[model samples]
Target: MNFLIASVSSEPSIDHAPFILSGVLLSLVVIYLASKIGGEISNRLGLPPVLGELLAGVIVGVSALKLLTFPESGSDGSDSVIMWLLQTTLGLPASEVSAVFTQVSDVVLLLSELGVIILLFEIGLESDLKQLLGVGAQAVVVAVIGVVLPFAAGTAGLIFLFGMAPIPAIFAGAALTATSIGITSRVLSELGKLTSKEGQIILGAAVTDDVLGIIVLAIVASLAKTGTVDLGNVIILIISAASFLVGALLLGQLVNKLYVSVATNLKTRGEIITPAFIFAFAMAYLGNAIHLEAILGSFTAGLILDESDERNELQKQVVPVADLLVPIFFVTVGAKTNIGVLNPLIPVNREGLIIAAFLIVVAIVGKVATGLGAFGQPGINRWAIGVGMIPRGEVGLVFAGIGSSSGVLSESLNAAIVIMVIITTFIAPPLLRVAFGISPDLESKELKTEVTKES
Candidate 1:
């Protein structure tokens, strides 16, 4: 049986440092086992392995086994079964359980965050910068329409259909506008469509969507907190996000010219890969400091490094690191999700589930229409473009989490948003693969062309 864990913010007992270390390692053991087993199962079933990894997280997480949980999202506790097991095996004192759980979960969360940065960097490395530039205009169109459609549709539907308050309806609508770049990019790379016209449009739009979504988030969150929107802050965010992307790209161009020479002279074991990480991490740090996503910075770093003579070598070396880290990210996103909100057996949950149904419809249809935004691309996979933008993933959760914590959302409304995120994030991968199922020869030719260019 699963347990709902309440959290306390306190320092770990120094005396139980060994027990804390054991807890973290144990959690990682669960994570790795779940990820690999789930991924392999999905691969065998002809679905994206990331899907299996996510489902495996759901199995081990709050929805099923209760083995993996996050207290910061308003659930999980120190006295849960994991803590009990640690106490039984490690002789950890009851007084130290909360601190240990917090420490271990915090470490795991950090690792998950690191995993995504590496994943985005790897994606950036694989992307054709020139191709991405070519589709930049279509991407902007896709991003704006993708955001406006979902936000407008969701907000209106809730207000008209369910009589939800304007503030809460807006927050839920805001959740729909996000596209998970990590998830979409991973699927594209696996499909060998990273260089295809459709793939480029998807990647560009997802990045653009994230920036615009963040701005929308700021506006909604501000609306939730204070009745009036801070026009000034919104303007600053717009300018800051634009400048960061442009500055990072321009700066990376200059820095990368010297980077190849610097790596050539280094004699250490990690000469090439080590310095690449240093650069990626620095950019990631700056991005976070400026309120932009860290993954954005890392992705930019990958794009910059991709231009170097050592690009192939960098890709080869980065894989081992990505293999070690990226699954953690996918798993944790699933693990943190509390799917209990959709329980049909409970009377109170039925209403939220019904609203979730509406949100889900809007989320899927609104994003699918975004494929049409890629205008003038003859014979392109419009459905694939739409599917690529479908998964709200972590970005949607961020919106739901903020809305819930800030008291702007009712219990039913919050539950509906979470369910919308879970479903959209889960369904998009397989749908994307199927959408790209044109004639086998043509698809294979596209892959071959991209491979030749990358090689």
Candidate 2:
């Protein structure tokens, strides 16, 4: 133990004892407070609370406040004390502690995945399947175009501008493919368009976009790992994803049927909610094992359940859990981000930033055209559809995290991706309002109408 301590000390300035205990406690409190304040501010401005939460994170992180900083090799920085303390408490090497922190970040990420899945499930549950079917082709077209264009633009631009190696650039483009459906959903809900036919198509298309983005991420990850993009692997992933969806739907139907039988016969709830949660987690695990995103599994579980009968009850129960866990995911996402890494004082390459900027533009423009994919749908403005798809939120951050951990993205690239995420999230609300021509007073009336209609 003494030898180990000496070795650890030789490498860095971490004191190991007080740092670990204090850091964890401090991090939790800061994250909670930041999220609360950020969420409240965001709601007041008609923005997704996530934007506020992230901004709060930025405020607390190294960028503005300089309150927290991750330690770097040979850097004489104030955050080094905190970083050292974390290293010592974990009783691991500095690198190992960083790895552990990254893993913990994944737990938060998993919950974020759950949040998006639930959001999508809610969309599916509320949807008129018949109406969705009618607009399915249009949604598919728009989603595909929306995904394809941005991906191509981002990949090409990164290759040309940043001279990034092929695989990393491809990963960057794949990262841009994600659309934050929650952003669009909230905006539409505010605009009183959530029940509109266009709204339905947009929601459906956003789902499609997310699924496609995940596939692309998997492919990019595989390519980065092996230095080859295998057609067979891509085909297999697609098949697996499709199979997962179908299997989930089938299982959901079976479960719903069984529940109906039992409920009708016994007139008991039968602790169905617990099993539902179990099934959701199980699906998420299975998805990970299959090299697909866990969110897909959670979403499939939501789609499979008896929405007609249990939707409200399930939402009420699940939302509280989502509320508690999901914010940690977002706040942790902010915590992991170190904006000081972007400072010119840092001896990092700037090419990543240039590539990141190009990709950000591509991400923005690509989804905007998805609205055009709403072609021939009455009362649907393609621009609105496109704007709705702009918020990258948690999904984009997930991709960035994957890329960073896998070495497909360097630190500078990761920072750039974080900046892009912030921009995309920040821009969505105001742009959404403008696109839909929704003013404050008009929005108030619409909200009243929705409340009354629901009542």
Candidate 3:
């Protein structure tokens, strides 16, 4: 028996109805509580909450305390507590129990996928296209350089140095291409410099980076599914993704207008938010239909609806739902990780560690090189802007998750990416402080001052 599964099998069987109710409740309680504690600790340590959540899952996962159990592949294993709960207590047939477990896993996966959609949509809702455009040539230059250099460096390094296969290498390179501006934005905001030229450029560039990253994600996922790469197919995929965004945006405007009109007349609950979610979900489905990631469509939906007066209310309603679901996704990503691969004593594990170290170096350098893209604007702190873009955070994790799910990244490579994410996230706050010559205390004071001024 797989030790992990066997450990869970010691639980006593209960009545069918109670077993399911208690099992689900107990599992979620453990996941939520553990993730929460971990995130709190991480935040106290100046690390990203996602880091803590991931670690929490690892602590409770198969490779560790085995508090949570997933069914093992093939036979030669005892049923896990989860499996036994369904099969023995629930009196499900062996095959039905297996099917039920798969369904349970699928539900978790689907919820995580939905969390991604909601996250992208929230990002879109917060984005101001006019302001992004106003940042002008500097933003465009930074975004382009940021995307291209990191991508080229990551792909080339993986291919040449690590001898990674082309397809997986491309996925790795693409993972390096996105910058999670949220971390940088938060730090800049704390420093009372959100409106500074450097800050605006970083914000604009990060937005542009997000757009490009989603498109690249679509392209890579399509490539993975097709198992081949060709110019024609690539062009088609690009066009399909673009067209889906355009069409969804145009149609979504009409949908929003109709929703508003009907809601104003009907005076029903969830009028604005309900339609917003419907449109987002519909667009996400449409994106998947066209072989694009659902986030592209959901994000575009947010962009479109944001053009209306209903945006604030939509955001207000969505935030609560997002708060509840998003953490689940991050925790699941962590749970799926096999941290055993991080051990350097094992040969393959050591290789992964080396690759991770190299990727971290590449991730930092590539973004730093993007500071050069701020060329014409000599007054701006170009290097500071580069440092600002360095933390990949949630975006990198999302890409890694997608790559793993799609089979485009092996376990070793996934672990490397995760390590890169953790280190970058941990370091970026202090690095940004140093780059900008601001102390933590000064940053806090500045933030408080700004808040008072605003008030």
Best candidate (score: lDDT): 1
**Where does candidate 2 stray beyond 4 Å?**
1-23, 62-134, 195-197, 218-228, 259-270, 306-308, 344-349, 377-380, 438-455
What is the lDDT, from 0 to 100, of the residue 348 in candidate 2?
66
Residue-wise C-alpha lDDT for candidate 2, range 80-187, written one tens digit per residue: 334455556555565555644434334444544555555544434443443434557888898798789988988888778767778877887888888877887887
Residue lDDT tens for model 3, 1-455 = 69779779866543344444545555666678878999999888867787898788777665575545444212111344556655556666564455455545566566777888888888778777566557689888999898899889999999999898878888888888888878889888987778877788899999888877888888887888887778899899889887876676667668768767765665688777777888789888888887888888887877777777777787899899887877777776676666778798888688888888889999989998888898776456787889888988888888887887787787778878877887788788888878777423434556999999999
- What lDDT, from 0 to 1, does candidate 2 have? 0.67
Model 1: worst 10 consecutive residues (lDDT sum) = 1-10
Question: How many pairs of residues collide in each model?
Answer: 2, 3, 0
- Compared with the true structure, what per-residue lDDT tens digits does model 1 show for residues 384-438? 8998999987667667655755678765676677678768877888898898885
Q: Please tell me which predicted candidate would have the highest TM-score against the true structure.
A: 3
Note the Cα lDDT for every prediction shown: 0.79, 0.67, 0.77
Model 2 Cα shift for residue 218 (angstroms): 4.5
Question: Can you list the residue pairs that collide in candidate 2?
Answer: 14-84, 16-88, 371-382
Q: Of the candidates numbered 1 and 2, which has the greater TM-score value?
A: 1
What count of clashes does model 2 give?
3
